[model samples]
Structure formats: C-alpha cells, structure tokens
Target: MPSTQFSLNIRTQPSREPALPCHETSEQARELVRGTSLELYSDGALHGRTAMVAVEDPLRITVSGLEDIILSRTPGDDEHLIAGHLFSLGLIRTPADILGLAFPDNDPGHAVVRLRTTKPRRSLGPLPGGPRIDPEGIFRLRERFEQRQRLYRSTRATHAAALFKADGELLAYGEDVSRHCAFDKAVGLALENRLLAGVEIAMLTSRLASDLAAKAAMARIPVLCGFSAATSAGMELAERRGITLIGRIGRDSFTIYANGRRLDV
Candidate 1:
C-alpha cells in the first residue's frame, strides 16, 4: 500500500466535542484496571515496581426477543458495549430501539436491554457518504487520541476506538481489552448521544480486522483508520462498504489500504 503526504499544516485545538461520561462509581471504574507490584529486571538489576494491568471480565448482554451474547472486555461501559454490539449485528436500527437497560442488583456485569423497535432486526446496504479526511488532520487526531488513552498509556494492554469529526474533533472514545469491544463502545457512546450520524472518521488503536471494519460499516462511519495495520479481510470489507480504510498511521504519513478517493484526494 502507498502512503501519502499532504502539504497542509495542522494545529492542535481544545476539545469542544460532546463526550459521554461513564456513570459508574470511581471505585468501580478503578477496578477495570489495577496496578500490580512486581519485580522489574532491567539491565542486570532486579527492582520492585508497580505496573498497571487491564482486567478482562465477562459481560453478559440480554436483548429483548433475542438470545444472550457474552463478551470478554474490560469492566466499564457495559451498556454502551451492548448497544454497539446489537447495532453491529443489525439487531436494532437505532438507539431508539432500546427502551432501557436493567442490570442485576447482584451482578453488574449482566445487562438486560429492553427493545421496543418496530422495524426489522436486520439491515442492509453500505454506509452513507459525507466525510472527507485530510491527511494532516489524521496526524493531529492521532496525537489527541493518544493523549486521551490513560489506561492504555499505563497498561499498554488496552485497545481503543475513537470517532472524530472531519475537522479533528473527537466525538466519542472507548477503551477496552478487546479491539472489537472498544469500537463497539465508541459507537455505542455516539448512538447514546445521537451523534453517530455526525461521525465521520473512526480510529482504532489496534489493527483493523474484519470485525472492526464490519462494525464501522454497520455503524455508518465513513472512514476507519488504525494505528497498526489493516487485515486483508478488513480492507475488502471496508472497500465494499464504501468506507475509506487507512492504516499504519505515522507522524508524517499514513498508508491507505482502500477507497482513497473518499479521502481528500
């Protein structure tokens, strides 16, 4: 794949986008990732050090009139995860289909979502068009996304999914142990705030696999970029779904895996 270098200057700006707040207790949030004291054998000396590790837990999703779906993900934003998962599977058209989420008093990991959708459970077709991303803007958004990944920075074991406006505004953010779950959480956040339609670009901290690409297509996000790389199936899916897939993003340039014409070419 070829990389591009656009000659536009980029600038960092303050966050003005709407972001959903996690309503969980701080202690519960902290439990998602914990710090462990361990021995660090660097060079030739062994020393005690505390390292942060992401905790992967099971989340059981129960949707109305459907079978249960279980996911192993970091223990936060369970509702958003379920919403995004359902949306990706075409179970419900929009967040409006969701009536409410009920969690067991004994098990916060289990979520039961009541669906009041009148439409069909499955959907078809490619995503809509309107997003145009500048290569320069990609670098800027990558910087901002990295700065916001507090858990990833501390643990380096978490993946993240972020949705950005074409102009570089971050619309939503999701971090988790699973790349797919991260993307779903971000989409779920956008859906909750009714901002999914306004989303232009989706960024992933990990590689762009078929699952993430499919999720982006299902969520109707036009562009999907990854910090690492894009798998062959992911590239094909993005191309078929009218998505511009970008990968191997570096400070100076990024590789366009498919649908370059949709970019600011």
Candidate 2:
C-alpha cells in the first residue's frame, strides 16, 4: 500500500492520558502478534530485533442460541464486530433489532447476539440520497482516515475503516487485522452512537472488495472510498446498490468505479 502523507495537528503532541482500560484481559495480549526474534544482517552488520505484528483469532458468532458463523478478527471491539456483522449480513435493519450482545464468561472468543425479531436475512437494497461529495472532500476524508490509524502506524499489519460525512467530517474509525473486521467495527461504532441515520461515506485502507461494498450498502452508506483498487464484483454490486465506489485514492486524485455523479470533479 502507498504510504499516507496525511498528518494531523494532534500527531505532534504526546498523548498524556493513559490507554483506555479493556474489560477483557486476554484481548490485550491477543492484539500483539508473537513470533520468534530474528537477526537482520545489513551492510556486513548483524542486528537482532523483535517486531510487533497484527494478531488474528477466530470468533464464533451465534444468534439466538444458534451457531451463525465464525470470523477471524484482531480480538478487540468484539461487540462492534458482531453488530456490524449482523447489519452487513442484512440480518437486522437497525440497532434496535438487537436485544442484547453477550460474550461467554469462560470464552471471550465466543459472541452471541440476541435479536428482538427472527426475520430472515435479506440482501441490501438501494440506498437513499446522500450529500454530494467533491473530489477534494474525498481526498480530505481519506487523509483523516489514514491519520486515525494508530494501530496500523505502530504495527503496519492492520487494516482500517473510517466513517465520514459527505462533507468530510469523520464519525468513527476502526482498525483490525482483517479488513472486513475493521469495516465492521467502524460500522458498529456508528450504529451504537446512532450516527448512521444520515447518509454517510465509508473509507477503507484496504481494497474495495465486494464484501466491503455490500457492507456499506447494507449500512445505507452511499459512498465507499478505498486506498486501493476495487474488484469487478465490487463495482457491479456498488452500481446495483446505488453506492459510489471510489478507489485508488492518490494524494489528490481518485478513480470512480460506480455512481460517479455523486462525486463532483
């Protein structure tokens, strides 16, 4: 992936506040990828180093006491992951449909979502009208999205997803070992905060795959931008779902694969 040149004013200052406490202790350790230390030889010199990698673990999701599916994630934001997963899969229309989310006391890797309704899942339909975004606004949103990727900056092994308004205000951001998980986390955060009622845009550090495009469509986001290319299936889905898919985001340029009318050049 191309390096992001975007910088935020907050980046210059050290964060004085301690990291937020996590409810699950095991989750913290799982975020750190472990591997044997290795020695590097360069320019006739040898140096030993330990590197931090992104972690991936399987999470089993169950709905109403029934096994649904399993996902590999980076361990944190399990609740958001479940919420986003359900929404993207078209299992629930809104957050109110979710009665409660729980993790097993003995197994943090297992999550169950209790729903108020047992409706059959459906595919995402066409989205409502969203605010028109210009090329400059897309660039700014991507820059802000990249700036919020703290974990990726540290490990360089994580993917990020950010929710932004068409006008370029960032709503929420998520980073995880898997691109899908990252997108789900961001969507989950927005849903919890009731921030997805309005038409929004989703920016990702990963490629615009069909799955991610479908997630954005299901979430009712009208625009999806990525730092990389979009798959053919993704473009087709975006076109059918009324989503404007923008990919290959450069510093000041981007390619619109679908719904270009929403993007003012």
Candidate 3:
C-alpha cells in the first residue's frame, strides 16, 4: 500500500517593521504579488513550476471599539482603505472624524482608528447633479488607471478603483485583491486629502455590483463606470441614487445602464 502526500506553500515579501499608524505610510508598500513555487499539472504530467500569485492580507479594522470590519485585501494603504470603508458604511463623515489609526500590538493585520465623531448614519439622500464628464475624458482616465495597475499586471488577480474630478484630474487611486476594498481605498485617499467632495467620477475594473453602487451613493459620487457588465441591482441603485452608471467599458464603446445625465451623450 502507498500513500500520496499533499502540501501547500506560499511566498511573501521580505519581512520588515510595518509603519506606525500615528503617521501616514508610503505608497512604496504597493508590491502585492509574489513568485510562488507550485506543482503544475499539464499534459498528463505533474511537475514543479514557478508562478505569480496575488497577496491577500487580512486587516481587522476597529473604530474605538464601536465598529469592526475585517477586510481581505492587498497589503498597502491600510489607513486610507479603512477610512474609506468606514465612510461608505456611513460610520464616519470625513477624515477629521478619524483622530488617528494604529496597528494593535504592532500587528499589521489589525488596525484601530480613534474616532472623534462616531455618530450613526443619517438618511442617505440621492447624489447631486451637474459636473458631467465627456467620453474622451473617460478614455484618458482609463489610460492613467492602466498605467497604475502594477499588481494586476503581474498577477492578474486584483481589481482597481480610481477617483477623478469632473475635468479629468485624478484625485486618488487604489488597487487590491478585493474589489470593494479597492473602491474603499480610492475613496479613503480622497477623504484623507479632503477631496471627497471633489470626486465627481470613479472608475472600477471587473463586474459592477450593487455594493459598489451603494458605496458610490453613500459617498455621493456622481458618475461611476465599470469595465464589465453591471448587475441589475447595480443599475437600480445607480438610478435611484441619481448616479450615472457606465458599464462594459471597451476600447471605444461602453453601455450606460442608468442616469446618463453625467455623460455628454
């Protein structure tokens, strides 16, 4: 009798002391892929192989012991990411609401944000109108967004979100293994810079879903475009929120599922 052995292994970046949460961290920590040694089964032959794998890290966010959420995302921009997520949930209004962020026990997996205002969410009204965007501007934004996808280019395992002004100026950007987290990071970056009110448009890769629509609604972003198709729920949310929703973005064509007022048409 013989037994087959199975093993699992993963590789990570070199260990270093994570940044103290008292201050903002550098964007250099955006490396989110690794060269992994793995078993390859091809053409009826099993062999060893080396491949690029996405880095998925767990981040526990606690808001002064009031609210908590664990996000499975890439390993960077931890502070902004959490702030954006909290804001989208209507837990915090602006960056000033967060007094500070810290890593508990110096553990990167856990983060705590001391909040100055922890009021429950108020009514979520529809987004504002005006500040429409031209199609040409969307194309240019896509060009810039593609250039910033360092992790997705290597591992093809991450989604991205970018916030821009009505005139096509980029406000903030985020890329992560989780689509929701990516969008949160973008919003968080904007919040940190006090530009949340200026984010008139946002673009995200992958399928457009209701959750994203809700986040956009909560953040009051006027326009949202997704690279792939939008779910029915997403379209409904956009319509209700008065947000222009563009989906299935292609080289020269895209579909607007709802609220086309923000597009030149």
Candidate 4:
C-alpha cells in the first residue's frame, strides 16, 4: 500500500478551469491466476493438487466527487478500466474531460477521477453509423478475440473484449474476471491512446447484455459482436443507438440483432 504518482500534462485552450494534478499508479500484481491446492477425487482415488484460479478484487471508481462505482475485477489495467467505465456510463465525453486520476496510496483498489466539468455529461443522441463490415470480418474478429484471451487459457475463468477497425484490424484486447471490466479496459486503452478516432467494432466472449450494448454506444463504436446470445434489451438498445449488434457468432453462422445495415454478407 504505497503511493506513487505520475503527472501527464494535457494541453488545452486557456480557460477558467483550474488545472488539476493527474496521477498514474498501478498495483504490482498483474497475474490473473492464484496458486492454491485443492483436494480432488478422480478415478475413485483421492488426489490432492495445486490449481491456478482466477483472481478477483474490488475496484472502486470515484468520479468528480459525485458518482462512484465499485467493480470486482482482476488486478491489472485498473486505470484503463476506470476511464473506460466512466466513458461507457456517459459520465465523460472524452479522455480530456478527465483532469486527474489518482490511485489511493493506502488502497490499490481505489481510484479517484477528477473531471474538468463539475457535472456528469450525458450522451446527447444516438451514435453515428459507420461503414459496412463483412460478415466474414465479424467471424475473423471473434477468432482473434478468442486467441487473445491469455488469462482464460490459463485459468478458464476470464472473459475478454477486443477492439477492431471496421475492416477487422485488431486494435486492443483486454481480459478480466468479468465481461464488463474486460470491455471497459479495452475501451479505456483506445480512449487513452486516441485509437477510437476511426470506425471501430467491439467483440466479446460473454453474452451481449443491454448494459454492455449501451457501453458500446457510449463509446461511439458502431458495431458489437459476441460469441454468445444477446438479450432482448440489448437488441433494443443497439437499435436505438444505431449500433449493429451481432450475436451467436459461430464458425459458419451468426445472427444480427440490430442495425443490419452496417453489415454485409
């Protein structure tokens, strides 16, 4: 529980807003799995062995001294997760909106984000449409997404989210104990690096839920693809936001639940 801070100077037009200090800090542990021994009964014989299990911990996000959310996630990419989460929740429009981000010295699990604006900014309207993505491109993106899940391969207890260009160029990948955290981390990376300026799509290993679809919309991603099923609410949200939501993406087939205009067979 030590405190370390790094400052990033962001250039902006002269304004009355006071400049706030930004701190970048991270936890030391980045491994996704914890080693523990468990007793197993296999082939009618007692077998005691060591196992690697997925790690989960609480991450508290405080935004501009007003709204806060606590998430249970793996111990890496915490800053990205918080940034992405705030963006996904429509709390901030751009990365520059965040004036400062501080990780608590006494607690590695807590983060405080000071915003340039005093009040949360809500999404004004539906996201704009993007270029068409080939159906094959969606499958290719899913394949790449699966290949990037190092944590899941090790512990079989993680979910992943990957960002790709409309033409299927992979941009960033994030993995975590939960689908939401994984997606948030990926979006956060894109935001921090200004990688989302191009038309983009997001693919996930978990089921497509309404909230997840909403997050994609908030990020202004035009397409969302998942290897699993999609909820009815998810479809509704996607349609309203002009985001194409594709689910049940298999090797040979897939279903488009909303905004089919964005995808071409």
Candidate 5:
C-alpha cells in the first residue's frame, strides 16, 4: 500500500492528574509523544491490575472550517480520516469523483484534493423526510454487525466502522480508538478507490450523536447503524437529514431512530 506523509511540530505538555471521586490518589497523568505511538494496556488479573503503560499523543484531524476533531483510540494513516469523512457525507459518489489527495510539501494541516467531479454546490434538499426505517434492511444490518465486532476482540481498544451497499456488501472497514478516525478511514478508503456511490449503509462503533448523524446525512448515506447508543440530538439530526439512525444493535434486534422508509421492508 502506498503511504502519504506529513509532519507536526507537537509540543508535549505535562500530563495533569484527573479528578477522582473518592479515591485519595489520582493516577498521575503520564506524558508521551502525542501521535507517534500506540498506548497498549494489559487485559487481566494481577498484570492487568498494574498500570501497564506506553506514551503517545492522541491523533486529531482538523477540517478547514470545522473545529479540530480528535482521532484517538485507533491509529493509522490520517488521510484516510478525511477521505472516509467525505464518503459518509455523500460528497464523493464514484471512483472518478475523487481524483487524489495531496498534502503540499510544506503545509502540514491542509490537504489539496483532486475531485473526480466538479465540486458541487452545497445546497442540499430538505432533510430526507420519511418513515422511521424499513424493517428488512434494519434487521440485516443488525446481523452484519456481529461479523464487524470481531475487530474489537483484537484490540479491545479500537472502535470499528464499516460501509455497506444497500444489499449489504461490505465495501470498506476501518478501526480506531476514535470514532471520528474510524469513520474517516472508512471514507478515505472509498474516496481513494472511488467506491462511495456504491455505498448505502454505514455502521459505526460510536454513539449516534448529532455530529455523526450530520456527517452521515451530509454523505447521503440512507442508513447508519451504531454498536452504541444514540443521543437525542443525534436522533434529531438523523430525522432532519433524512438519514436513518439505528442503534442498540444486537444479533436479533435494533432500534430505528429516524427515516424508516429507507429501511422499509
């Protein structure tokens, strides 16, 4: 796989101790480089009880106008973060739409993208209004989720995101400790390969919140499912954007938060 490189002049600050409820000693904040390494933790009894630690900076991606969103949890190429974000928002539809992404030689935070199509104007139709969700697609989405959670078994520390076609073909998958990173990576993969148009469903391992629902709505995905719960604000956004927000997914059931017609049986 080809890689894109960019550099950051990050300043490491002293780790401040977090406040504790009743405990006397707050765990000392550990200091380390922010983005260069993964912090691995142990899993069980005696050893797990110990503070097994490593140092690294939390990963973050800043869009030109959007505030800098932190991408901690899972780690990988940052470019994927941007690409995956675009895919979920429905901006890039086909392989030819996203030409390529380049981080200029000296600019670290800015990325210049070659679009497959002329950048369309931002005016979007009214929030996709309709029934809450179609039943069949919602059920199938719940089933596909089991296969996706296997990634969590490996890192226990990473969040996963997957993009699916309407019929449920898995198009792209990404994992990061940060839900934002996970989605970004997934979108990046689609844009890099021009596969967004083929995507109809997105499953994220994060809470279905306003920002997330907004992104999926912007990407034009019809439905989004999450392993975690959805906030009231997220439900509102999904309703307004015409995106179906499904959460509390299990092997047999799931909750449909908005735009049911898209999930119509």
Candidate 6:
C-alpha cells in the first residue's frame, strides 16, 4: 500500500488516565509513528539521520462545465479546492456563484462542482487585474518566507508552499520534494479543515508556472507569488484564468506578470 494509505490513528500504550503534576515520579508520552530512519557511518564511527514521509490523501474533483461536459480529476474536494483555488486566482469574487457540489460514488479520487453562472471564460494573458503589494508588503513577504524555510534548514528540501492572507499574515507552510505535492498538501489540509476560502495569496517557493497555475486555478486563488521566473505557459494560464502571477521576487523587489489591473497598491 502507498504510504498515503496509512491510517492516522497512532496507538499509544497508556490509556486515558489523569496525571498529577505534583507527583514525584511520573511518566508522560505521546503516541507517534516512527518514521524512516537511517544509521550513518563515517570511518566506522556512528552518524545519525532520520526522515519522515507524510501521508498524501488523493482526492478527485468533478466540475460541470458548459454543454454538459463534466470535468473530473482526483482534485480531492471539488467544492473546497475549486473554490479555494479559484479564490486565490481571482477568477471568482463570491462563494454564492457556486451552485452546489457533487461527489460521485465509487470515485475515490474526485468530486464534481456545479456553478450557478457560466461566466465567459477569458484567454490566458499577462497580469491583468488584482491587488498589488507595496515594498513594505514585499519586504514582509520575504522576511516571513525566510523564517519558514525550516525544511531547507533541516533537510535541504527545495520546494515549499505557504499560505498568506491579503494583509500578509502567515497561516500555514509545508515542504516536499515535489512542488505539486507540497502545494497539494497545503491545499489539501486547508480544504480538509475548511480554511481554503480565507486564503488570499499562495506564496510558492518554486517558479510560477502552468502546473502550479493549474493547481492554483483549481483552487481559485486570486494571486500566486513566486521567487522564480514565470513560464510562458504559466503566464498564459494566469491571464486566461484571471489569476495574478507575481514572479522574480527579490529581497527588495518583485515583478508582476499578469492581471496588473487588480493590484490596487
């Protein structure tokens, strides 16, 4: 079975029992799954290494588009991920436009979303309309981003996904070898916990591109910010999908590639 199939139920030896802080001798332990570990050696001397593989829950999403064409993918939660991705991309304005959500039986990896209005779809283009952060906001984005690089600090992992509000409050962060998985896990967690709607920006540690753009589009995110360059496809999709793509973000500067009309300041 894939590691994602492992149940989250961690069993512990100690059953529920009251603990006394005043006790002279006492034992307290928390249940945890032992992740993979490695014993290293240098010149016959012992070295230490350990690793954890987070469980990934694959989900499917079904979207009912024009002409009765139903688009479905293992997008996890159809309503939440779609709403979340779309909100982040700026293609949607309110949740009321969503007609309803449908999860088809036996499709373990997907769900379908139905919309009330069929807005005219736009082709991908350069950054068009969305809120833009000033230098102070950009500075804060970099500072908070630097502090969240713990995965890199510990394991030298390359990809990370961070969630931020329009005001720039850091919400959640995760890292993975696969940029898709990293953002997927972030979006998955947010959907599982019903927090996707509140996110205003998804700050990615990877380049702004189409795949990421697709993920963000599925979630309806209004803005996607990256520290790397944007791909042609990514730029195109962002424009087509009405998502603001921010790329080449530096410590003291950044560039807006799509939907510049929406950036108020």
Give the better candidate number (1 or 6) by TM-score.
1
Stretches off by above 4 angstroms in model 2 are: 1-36, 41-46
lDDT, candidate 2, at 174: 80
Tell me, by TM-score, which candidate is best.
Answer: 4
**Candidate 4, residue 261: CA error in Å?**
1.8
Q: What's model 5's TM-score?
A: 0.62
lDDT of 6 by residue, 1-265 (tens): 1122222221132334311111111121211122567777889798787764332334444445534323322222233334544434444444545455443553434445565555644424433344555545866877788788754554454477887777887765655555665676567456544566666688888999898988777666778889899999999988888888888888777888987655666
How would you encode candidate 5's per-residue C-alpha lDDT over 1-265 as one tens digit per residue?
A: 1122223211123224211111111122323112232344566433322221222245444334445544443333445665565555555554345445444543333445555554443626544433334456656765676577644553355677888876667888776666777777777676555575566888987899888777676666778889789999998877777787788887677787776666555
Q: Count clashes in each candidate, considering only residues at least 3 apart in sequence or on different chains.
A: 0, 0, 0, 0, 26, 52
Ranking by TM-score: 4, 3, 1, 2, 5, 6
CA lDDT, every model vs. true structure? 0.77, 0.75, 0.78, 0.78, 0.59, 0.59
TM-score of each: 0.84, 0.82, 0.84, 0.86, 0.62, 0.54
What tens digits encode model 2's per-residue C-alpha lDDT throughout 126-156? 8657677878877777777777887787678
Q: Evaluate residue 230 in candidate 6 and report its C-alpha lDDT on the 0 to 100 scale.
A: 94
Error of 4 at 43 (Å): 3.3
Q: Which consecutive 10 residues in model 4 have the weakest lDDT in total?
A: 1-10
Give candidate 5's whole-model lDDT: 0.59
Show pairs that collide, candidate 1.
Answer: none
**Model 4 TM-score, all chains together:** 0.86
Compared to the true structure, candidate 1 yields what TM-score? 0.84
* Candidate 1, backbone clash total: 0
